[model samples]
Target: MRGGPAFEVLFNINTYLKKKGLRDKFELTFFAPMEKPGQKMGDKALLMMDKMFKSMDIHKQVGSKIVAFESDGIVFENGRKILSDLTMFISAGTGHTILSSSDLPLSEAGFVVTNEYNEVEGFEGIYAIGDSASLMGAKWRAKQGHVAEVMAKNVAYGIAMHIQNIDSKRSYMGQLNILCMMDTGNGAAFVYRSEKGGKMIPLPIIGHWMKKAWGVYCKYSKLGKIPRIPGM
Candidate 1:
């Protein structure tokens, strides 16, 4: 549906399916080019995905197009297959289809092109952020929640700075990192990834409680009853 790691989206789908009691009728699978995919989530989460898939009767396969139909659950380039009743597509790259509707300049993938500070070159006062803007950093740079939030905050700050007659603006480069708490039924794994690489730390039942507490904190803080922790 949107850019970011694929696991998060799959997790949401799985949760929804379980709630609907159709989780058994449908066989959930993860298809990618790599045989040992999900390195983005770190080794533990990757291993956990393997375990989860295996336990749930989910299949894993490598493919090029990763196609699916009503009769066949999914099909790959090598004649390999996994039958499914339904399928949904999610891309972790420039959401080009939507950009084709606009008149803005586009990359090969059709995302809007912008300067280092997120300004459109010839269009003053107009800016693009998040999934629509072309990234100025590494190609592996992903569109994540924090990046979107920071971009929004930076854009706001840029406006304030402009009103104060300032010259410089904020840059999104060097902010490439992934931080997330992965919840399992009874525990969680705290994952962090940066230029240095990645790490995943497992926690027991307390981790689940921490996540629940975090949900409450998030709700209360968003409603202005509590303060939000920095970098959360």
Candidate 2:
């Protein structure tokens, strides 16, 4: 659950299946260590993850991929040997390192240091957001679409405030949340988290349609064929 990309992809796939009303035929096979798997989404999302997994009959294969010698590919703990098929390592963290090494203030974790307003400390007219920037508060803070949207809006407002000399300043520090919609095979659970608390709202039957409607809305809105609803 600690920034596991595979888990996130599986979650999205589950949502897609549920929205399409094709959950019955599919069996989700998770190859992980523990029974109660950890999801990167916050407590509420985590609860929904647990609920979804609990509803399923899962088979656990507890084995780790142990890399043996550098010259040759490694073997698994299950005694299965896999030869290399064009070994390529995609650098996920190195991109952050490249940004941090620039002439900019960086956090200890090697991410660009930015204020609550998404402004880099010493660099004027420069802002940072998304995975490239370190979220300053809440240990459970996640890199999510809504958070990025908020930061983008804040950046726009911050620029306007600087230019128009407005009193209102945007800050994302206190707005850290874990609002997410998790879809199971047949339904979805609405998850929300804040500094105050967290909650998981389970939805069934019609919930699938709601998600489909959301996807349609997203697509049409992005194409400017439809208007985006407020807070959507």
Candidate 3:
């Protein structure tokens, strides 16, 4: 696991497996290159993860760079190998190479540089949202679907205001936050993080259903088949 929300989902799944007496049947191990994975969620979240790892009997290998993946398992740069029957790896996302050849200003990672309202520099009315734009705030900032939605809405509002000659404009900067419902097979956790702090709330059975409903709502809302709630 590469850490963040994806790792949290796996952690919750491990807990569910243990409660169902199926943990012994499967070997689950989490590995990351960073020594302190999930630390970006704040100190409280980091402590909670540490506690969960101990109480759930989950194995972890950190601070080790991965060199390659063999048929059996992973190979580390330190010449250490861990054999496993199955391996699940989640790699980080990168910008498209096509952005490099475009006229837009790009970050070193090749993401389009944009203002707070997602307006691409030197491109006046043009805007770049979603993973295509480079975030411009905290170092721990991540490209998430919710943040992309925020940017999209902001750009839309900005465009409308411009056409109407309204002084009002929206910016995605103040809206930056990590909000996720990490689901397990049986339950889910509400994880939230902002500049002030971070909090993780355990939602047992009902949480799973809530996440499922959210998925349904998102799908229908995006297709305009159902009405979307404000700030959803």
Candidate 3 TM-score over all chains jointly = 0.89
Using alpha carbons, what is the TM-score of model 2? 0.69
lDDT of 2 by residue, 32-103 (tens): 433443443456656666556556542233346443424544455667544543222312353355685589
Specify the highest-TM-score model's number.
3
Q: Could you give candidate 3's per-residue lDDT for residues 25-74 as a string of tens digits?
A: 98777777778888767778778777767766778887889999999999
Q: What's the count of clashing pairs in each model shown?
A: 2, 0, 0
Clashing pairs in 3: none
TM-score for each predicted model, relative to the true structure:
0.75, 0.69, 0.89
Estimate every model's Cα lDDT from 0 to 1: 0.69, 0.65, 0.81
Runs in model 2 with CA error above 4 Å?
1-48, 60-101, 108-110
> What would the per-residue lDDT of candidate 1 be over residues 45-81, giving only the tens digit for each residue?
5676677667556666653655544464667767777
For each of the candidates, the C-alpha root-mean-square deviation to the true structure, in angstroms, is: 4.0, 5.7, 2.3
lDDT ranking of the models: 3, 1, 2
TM-score head-to-head 1 vs 3, winner = 3
